[model samples]
Target chain A: MSNRGPADTPPSEYEDEGRERLSYVVGLVLALLLTTGAFAVVWLDLLSGGAALAALGLLALVQAVVHLRYFLHIDLARSHRDDLLLILFTVLILLIMVSGTIWILYDQHIRMMA
Target chain B: MTLRGIVGLLAAAVPGTASAGSFLEPAGPIASAQFSHFGVISALMLIVIVPMFVALPIVLYRYRRGGKGTYRPDWEFNWGLEVVIWGIPVALALALGMALWKHTLEYDPYRALGPEPLVVEVVALDWKFLFLYPEQGVATINLLALPEDRPVTLRLTSGTVMQSFIIPRLAGQIYAMAGMQTQLNLLASETGDFIGRNTQYNGLGFATQSFTTRVMSPDAFAGWAEATKAQPAALDAAGFAKLLSPSVVSEPVLYGRFTPGLFGQVMARFAPAMVQGHGQAGMAAPPAPHQGHHHMPEAGR
Candidate 1:
């Protein structure tokens, strides 16, 4: 093992400057395609209601992954495990709070109408 | 001579001190239920809170340096201690969550309290409330008079910005937003004067946007409505336009006559699509013919 800490060590892929730039360009194109697809799905009335929602949600998820991998340089590599874990933990906390609130409020709404 | 004694004396001197505006001294069934709900929540919270406070000082003194408490420097996690520390809070949270869900459903503001409700169309304006009695063909600014023992169904909408309508002694607060209708059902149990107000801060005159809620016997209510209808003022389009201006109303203004379907017009102002098929200037929709039970024209949004 190397004496250098994880923070001090350079990522192997980033050592190739051309490949790093190519990854960014690829991520940008994919992000733009996904965004345009989402807009088209809504604007062109390609889908309605739940179907439309699901399609948009799928595109958004893809865009988020692309951004994370390219812009934020977060990935599933061994060196990036801490960053991924931190983000996942944050998402878990937000999901717990937001979903808990919605569940309670929606339950109340149904009961109120009943 | 004591501070507590002086406070007690002063409290006694103020007649009907907390009774008029406090949910703690509830004047209605809904408010009474809310008051008990509050009591229950507080008591449950105190079960956890009180112990923490009581243990804090005791723990500090017992574990202080050179004290009689056991000095276990090498001590690690104990399963029994861990369970106890986590278990109590988890159980308390579950209990509180269940209680909140149960009570929220039981006291829903939209749920009708009783039969044969007295309908009151409420419009929240800048620094004031306009209440229209569709059945009586009369309207009042900054005043809400209801017959005791009869449920009052309030269909609330805001004429300008968003506002919250609250009559603490009667029921809980409900939001009123421009172009959207919200409903609240409440029934005063006894004849008395309670305070009502817009709890949401909108602009400069928000502090003064309060109204007097008078609950009286059915017979007295009828008489008062008749007396009010005999007043000269009318809530015509021009008068309503004037009321739209931001100002604090010091005294309640009673309008004997008001334009029919005025409530719908106010709601339609924000949502023009609702009035699209009417084939008239949105403001000039034909006056609805007076019926025994005058239902406010629906703004089909």
Candidate 2:
């Protein structure tokens, strides 16, 4: 507990220079724009039916990726290999769950309709 | 599961209408099938769950302070054990998936049945069912009538939010999503009032989204249709708008005549022709070129 001293700490001046204040502002604005765009597609009923559904789905997928990359600071260089593998596995599992649900339900549709 | 929790779950799932000589049995085919599937899955999981519950105490006892057992600190993953663990589930899922696939196809309602059963277009709204008997040129809201012993095919859609079309005695609960059609086939063996309701929760009026399904003799059904047609006015576009207006506990209303191709018009309102063509392709004659060309890769390009 007694080993630390004020002179051993790095100055705050170096940290401030590395931070991109302008890029942070731009990233925030872009994120807001993407969110609004997603909302507009849904609110306007732009696609309707299957196309509309797929479009909204794609929008959500892209938005999730964007959030992970930018806001969460998840990237190839910054993240460990295990972290990237975990994310990939998680995405694969999610896809399997969603697609399997749709497939089984569609089959049920065919049967119930028959 | 505790007895209290299981009781609560059952109570929550079963409707209050069960004791009133309800139209359909609460624990019918779909409910039973789902229950059986869940039971099998849970039973298999219990193989691990129960053992863990038991072995956990034994492990704790053996590993206590100053315990007699020797410690092995350098343990690696057991590939054989992992293979056995994953293999058992994969095999079980494969068997279950196959069974589900076979049963699902066998019960397909829209497939061509004997003599092409009667068509009933059902629209579930806030708290009622609007049944349009296209072939009979009749429409009824909050009341469904069908002749006993005849296969009845229901084409279901929703006016707004998603709903589930469930007739417990007849078949499974299939979702009725807005602007999207889902089909169901059912036949009543005995003549009676069958309960039809929206199984999925929508909004405030969801509790009352129920209707009476009357299974009548062929002669009685014809008489009922005649009586309905004898009403003062027929259902038109404006009339439809009025019927579609969200309301609670709507009274049964019937119309002798409905606008021609009314269902198709409703289908087109939210979807392009190509979307409609997806379902109607094999059922009816090919859709018109201009309408069907909306999303087809060959034509859209």
Top candidate when judged by lDDT against the true structure: 1
Taking the candidates in order, what DockQ does each have?
0.07, 0.03
Superposed on all Cα atoms, model 1 deviates from the true structure by an RMSD in Å of: 9.3
Question: TM-score: which candidate is best?
Answer: 1
Per-model TM against the reference: 0.74, 0.56
Alpha-carbon runs more than 4 Å astray in model 2 = A1-114, B1-84, B112-114, B217-219, B272-301
lDDT of 2: 0.67
lDDT of each: 0.81, 0.67
Instruction: Report the lDDT tens digits of candidate 1 across residue range B36-153.
Output: 7776777789888998999999988999997778999999999998998899989999999999999999888888988879989999999999999998989999999999999999
Off by over 4 Å in 1: A1-53, A59-79, A87-114, B1-19, B73-76, B274-297
Clashing pairs in model 1, backbone N/Cα/C closer than 3 A: none
lDDT of 2 by residue, A40-113 (tens): 88798776555655666676677777677666767788699999999899889988997777666554434322
What's model 1's lDDT at B68? 77
